[model samples]
Target: MKIHLTSVLVDDQAAALHFYTEVLGFLKKHDVPLGEQDRWLTVVSPEEPGGTELLLEPARHPAARTYRDALVEDGIPLAQFTVDDVAAEYERLSALGVRFTQKPLETGPVTTAVLDDTCGNLIQIASRPR
Candidate 1:
């Protein structure tokens, strides 16, 4: 009846961790090594520590690579995160050197921006009038 966790396929988990935490401000929740090269890593929004977690899953499967690559090639975002102010968040992130494919644009009552996650995914940040 409720959402629990979701994931983004990442080319490098370590780099994704840094970008999601240090840049995007999510807090690390779980970090367990699954094998010699992979770890069961997840992060939660700082504002909702007990909310759904976002897993930074490794893109080890060939299908995952093809899917992600195709999405990127088509300028589609793999995931979207909600924020309070899309414009402010876009400015803050841009100042940190995050490359955005789409700048904040208003569409009806909602605004959104898309940025590269730096670990092989395009992410969208969105906000709607409160």
Candidate 2:
């Protein structure tokens, strides 16, 4: 079996869409209206257009809000995205005024950096040595 879709709890879907697409370089795959000012918005990486999608789920549910807040309070990342180079991605994002909680750091064979998603979540960008 393989992964299909995953989600990241977001306080604002519009803002999340902008960051995920315009900044993070993901492409909007699906955006169907779900009523009540909400939508079934999802994004996919350009390199893998048919791959797994990342849903920008609204954090309206009490449990989801609490969970997101708790993770943020503890400085934990809500999701991670693999990149070719953590440092380069960090620099590119930094230039776009993106705020990072942790600079790129090497940990054994992998490198990682954490950044605020501006949608109430900290997301990690990671790279592994080839």
Which digits, one per residue and each the tens of the lDDT, describe model 2 over residues 21-114? 9999999999999988999999999999999999999989988878888888888998999999998999999999999999999998999999
Best by TM-score: 1
lDDT of 2 at 39: 97
Off by over 4 Å in 2: none
All candidates' lDDT scores? 0.95, 0.95
List residue ranges in candidate 1 displaced over 4 A: none
Clashes of 1: 0
TM-scores for candidates 1 onward, in order: 0.97, 0.96
Candidate 1 TM-score to native = 0.97
Candidate 2: Cα lDDT at 62: 85
